[model samples]
Target chain A: MTTATQVEKEFILNMGPQHPSTHGVLRVILKLDGERVVKAIPEIGYLHTGIEKTMEDKLYYKAIPCTDRMDYLAPMSNNLGFSLTVEKLMDIEVPEKVKWARVILAELTRLNSHLFWLGTHALDLGAMSMLLYALRERESIVDIYEACGGQRMMTSYIRIGGLAKDLPADFDKKVRHVLKLLPEKIKEYETLLNSNQIFINRTRGVAVISAEDAINLSLSGPMLRGCGIRHDLRKANPYSGYENFDFEIPIGKNGDAYDRYLLRVEEMKQSLSIIQQGIDGMPEGPYRAHVPGVVLPPKEDVLYKMEAMIFHFKIITEGFKSPFGAVYQAIESPKGEIGFYISSDGTNKPNRVRVRPPSFLNLQSLSKLVEGSLVSDVVCAIGSIDIVLGEVDR
Target chain B: MEHNLNEIEEKILDFLEDKFSGSIISRDKFRGDWSFFIKPNDITLFCKGFLNNYELDIKYLSDMTSVDWFDHEEEKKGRFEVVYNFYSLKNKIRFFLKARLPAENPEIDSITNYFASADWMEREIFDLMGIKFKGHPDLRKILTPDDLEGHPLRRDYPLTWEQPVFTWNKDDPPEVIK
Candidate 1:
């Protein structure tokens, strides 16, 4: 007869590639010693579409649509990041109105992404009705996106030089309506999740990473902020007139699953305030910058004037030539820093278009986050990271 | 609390010149971010020094990626440039370090020892661009199948559509109609 200690051994357990709690098609191979995870190795690439390779073959103006697919949840934020990088490469200044409008749209995108994350994360923890309630609020935001740019999800409204078109007539009214309603809805969500004993037990003190470890791991946005390190790129490296907006960066203390949840809730409220400020201080000017042979001519002008027609034809056919230089532009997307390292070769097509996806980088910390936690906490830890595998495997 | 951007850039440049004088190949500033081009062999030492230094405590590795410079004649000193973007939370500054590697055998020293975040990023560069990292603990394909043939991001790789697996000729399709 053998003793129980003599027979004990560790075995490997594959958690995903199709698991519901992974937020996308992500596989985590966890090594377990009777329900305690000894090692967690993330396996990706199930959703890879080779978007970066495809971007290198397309023209500069045509690549904007590709960025939207990288982070499908925060399409507008992806658009803004890619557009801002191209604009920097071209060294053209967009109109004041365009900057304000971009800020407002991107903030709305942050709120939309956080709501989806909250709902899906809650559902992963067995709260079924939260998905329906969260989706109800998300519908209003999607309606706003639809009102501005014809598509709700993949609205590549933010173009390279400026916005694709002027804001709709009722854009302001629709946005204000949604902004007014989101706060109370957020409050209801907080009442449901916060202080609930079951929710607390599942989240708090689970997957705790120190501020030092968070920084060393290069975790950003909420993951770094959850560790009580205030490192938001919007405030640190302000771009697209983020400097003009007055808002607070929310920080969390515990760096656990619960702190991350609270931090995103606070971020949604701050995004609301930014939207209100952007609309209140909205500037009036031309929607797009007037860069000949680069920015597209207005449709009416292209129809009427010969010079406008010629410019449009040239831009559509040959695309604009950027100076032979490289620029790295990062924007604080809903997830974290979505950066575009664009190396233009004095041609219409980019030499190299590398996306520093936050999900891909943030997902690196999952092993550290769930090293010694329970198997159940593995689900919570993955949910707290809020990774969109579309972005991760892009 | 707002430090002068130019002064910070100058300070970093001076420190690099003072320590490792001849290693820097070229330096440029684009969009207010300082970029330095260095030899591929010196990246490990430079990254270690940058992380250990007190004034330039660039502990955060923002991004690590590789760019293929295939066609440009004048700009092609090397076929690949592995770029690393680092950020200093204490000083609120961002910097770029690019290491030039030859196209035929692209390899560079890994910085995973300094920043734990570099593990996945290095793996990604290896998988997509075929650039190997010397000391990466686990270097495998991250976003591609294990048996994927060629590096997709290379300029020479064909961007054509995948071939259809099955096709039906006229003779093969006629039997199903009865």
Candidate 2:
């Protein structure tokens, strides 16, 4: 008979600025005693590009594309938050059609982000096939984006004052197709993992956090909702015509990885309904708001008319001068509440542009959530939070 | 809606004036948002009141960031401003608190005791802006590497300045590749 040696000391393990399961360049310093994690200190900033500092040097309109790079998965939502801040500072109300169209695009972007999250979250938990199915559904949304914005992933479509252009002629057809196909596919995802023993064992009762702690840590969106807190910014403080839409905020009971997964899946369903409402009730008016010297003129008008050409030239060259004040505008991003705080100094260039990235703040709770849990559960905890390092290190 | 805002504003202003009378330097209302400049030392006190007050239980801390005013055109209180974005989840309202720190050594008390989320926010501020957060448990560089010298977000830090090669690992000599 062999006698077991007693191991009393905790060893430190560095889990990657290069590991595959981390989803990006994120390094977690895990202090462990055998198989249990005593403390998990997440060391980020490997992917820091200083996008916020870069945005301050660029013109106001030039900064929109930079926002796209922050939350690469939810580019349109980031654009919306930045543009809403600029509009709020300039006091420009978008046309009704622009509002409705923005709503559709934003919800579609939310769907896009959630689909990617679901696929990666499932794959990390050893369900390999879920990724393929999730990516297939996500491709359709990308097609819609390419059709509208002329770019696939980094589509800076939603510009200040209005969209880059009008919605494509086939926008309605493509959106309705996605709206019809997603419900059944979402059910397929649920059927595959909802009852699977392995999935439940990996996620349920693992990396649990309470509602009060979640709030204290400033976790938002699905992270907060997973803790059974019914606080959705879209419902509580509606912006960009979100008040007009009818949807439900999903909450979970356990605040574990499983509950967060279910909440994200249900959120995808809610997003489909919102897209349906957007397409059905889109108002009829000018796609871009008429703000000369501020909003860019239509391409057709720029080609045909001299005044429109002059306005375009002015906006492109010098850029629009904004009033001297700061405004914080937040929107319900797929990850959480992504807000932009802009402080203008009566110049074309912004004096300060601070992005309140949800990923950065949400990732702060990683240490709190992963402490005292098993080492294997660390991946589950990170996946449940759904952090994009691009946004986290921005 | 506007009338209701006026009523809430009156009630909260009355309550704040009654409670924190001396700490509030000035207040401004713009674009339906209220901002108050509080004394740097009394921020934690105001935040405690904001959390425990029945009507103004602003428990959720949305964000905390710092702004550098090196070449700013506007007249300001100090060379640096730390902005706190607080929200009341129950009442669904947003407010701002700003504290000004002098140029010599910009320092403020960390709100980690009142709001746990301020840990990383203060660390980031300390890292990028070089504003010392007194009493923070882990006050170290966050978004930047450990070897970085100057605060990158300050106006004095040049945008095009480059870090010298192998400076971070200076102790380990580099071998020549023939």
> If you superpose only chain B onto the true chain B, what TM-score does each candidate give?
0.85, 0.87
DockQ of 2: 0.42
Q: Alpha-carbon interface RMSD of model 2?
A: 5.3
Candidate 2 per-residue lDDT, tens place, A1-394, comes to 1233344456677787798788899888888888888878888888888888899999888899999998899999999999899999888999999988988999999999999999999999999999999999999999999999999899999999999988999999999999889999999999999998999999999889999898899999999999999999898878889989999999999899999999998998898899899899988998788999999998889999999999999999999888877789888899999999887778898878899989998999998888888988999988989999999999
lDDT of 2 at A234: 92
lDDT of 2 by residue, B1-178 (tens): 6686677677777877888889989998767788888899998898788878877667899999888878775435798889999987877778898888888988999899989999999999999999999899878677886677899888788887777534322232112100
DockQ of each: 0.40, 0.42
- Superposed Cα deviation of residue A142, candidate 1 (Å): 0.2
Candidate 2 CAPRI assessment class: acceptable
**Model 2 RMSD vs true structure:** 3.9
User: Which predicted model would earn the best lDDT?
Assistant: 2
The 10-residue segment of model 2 chain A with minimum total lDDT is: A1-10
Off by over 4 Å in 1: A1-8, B1-3, B74-76, B161-178
TM-score of each: 0.95, 0.96
**Residue pairs in candidate 2 whose N, alpha carbon or C atoms collide under 3 angstroms:** none
Superposed model 2: Cα runs more than 4 Å off: A1-8, B165-178
